[model samples]
Target: MRDHGIGHIVGTILDAPENASVVKELKEHAREAGFKAGYNECLSHVNPFYKSKFTDERSGFHGVDTKALYAAAVDTYNNLSISAIDDIEEFLEAENYVDRLRLLYDYPEEEETASGSKEDAGTSGTKED
Candidate 1:
């Protein structure tokens, strides 16, 4: 049996931010921005961010779970940072929140080694120059 439970994993994520506060803040900002759907999408990223802390090798028999979570995280990031937020002003307002969420989720720099260091991380996703 696994020593760690889902509750423990969830706790680690929620520990950084009171879960209710996160929801309240995101809902208020996203709802006012006329992107309630984005709120749901943004909030959904937390699961994978936390879960990605566990690697496939560490996951034992449930390695697929780790892979799935990581994939979900990447997909969510791409969606939000690329497609979800369209307007520059609206996207700018929400990007900070999403960035915090990514940090809180413990985004894996090691896993993103192909990007060559976190500082070098670049994407044409949502921001406009």
Candidate 2:
């Protein structure tokens, strides 16, 4: 899990300005370490913006359910990062294959769904109409 989180930090650093040499070096290091480095060019162009009030509201819920909430939040972030990494790897592999085929194509990606069971539905293990 720490490695996954570090991957996200490394990815962000790689996208930062004045880090081209560091990014190149990291790519080589990742290759040696048997880690696949993914490029996220869009992250470099877009700045993430969030409502401060909304963030505070969410933070206020911190100790509401303490352990359960912390577990859920960590699980969610780890899952999201893993999914993003998987999507990037798939895109890169597809791009390489398409380039070899000399065919023009575009990859459309979408968010992955959570692995929830019917029992996970709120209230009694039954669907509500």
Candidate 3:
């Protein structure tokens, strides 16, 4: 399974300032939700592949351009926060403040498939038992 640790998730959240506010608000909401908002930079080492995919650029690499990548990351973070906050609001019965904090804790799946589906394509005439 892919490493979806907090640092990896939060680093994606912090990749863009537009999404940084979401991270900030999520931290605040987490504090109010009785969870500590811990910070860690360890994700840099957890998934070397993810790090290379998002931040590094090498010739012959077909990853998204940096600007587009950053924008996508922000959009992804916003969507997830939206979903999380919706769940939180339902749990807390705080419909009134849902909109305010919704964007904070939500994070939706990214629009583009990570690294595409090529990695999963099966070899012709190959079968798995």
Model 3 regions more than 4 Å off: 1-64, 81-84, 94-129
Query: Per-residue alpha-carbon lDDT of model 1 for 1-129, expressed as tens digits?
Result: 012223434565445344444455555444434443344355566558784543223322222333344445445434443222233235356535434434434444423356454342353223454
lDDT tens digits, residue span 1-129, model 2: 132333554565455443554445445444433321111233233435533312222333322444444455445434443433444456446535323222222222222347543321232312234
Between candidates 1 and 2, the one scoring higher on TM-score is 2
For model 2, the stretches where C-alpha displacement exceeds 4 angstroms are 1-9, 13-63, 81-87, 95-129
Regions more than 4 Å wrong, model 1? 1-4, 15-19, 35-129
lDDT of each: 0.41, 0.37, 0.41
State which candidate, 2 or 3, has the greater lDDT: 3
Which sequence of candidate numbers ranks them by TM-score, best first?
2, 3, 1
lDDT of 3 at 67: 41
Give Cα distance to truth, residue 87, candidate 1, Å: 36
For model 2 the TM-score comes to 0.24
At residue 80, candidate 3 shows an lDDT of 57
The sequence of per-residue lDDT tens digits that candidate 3 reaches over residues 1-90 is 022223443554456565566666655444433311111123344457564433323323224243444455555656755433344446
lDDT of 1 at 63: 23
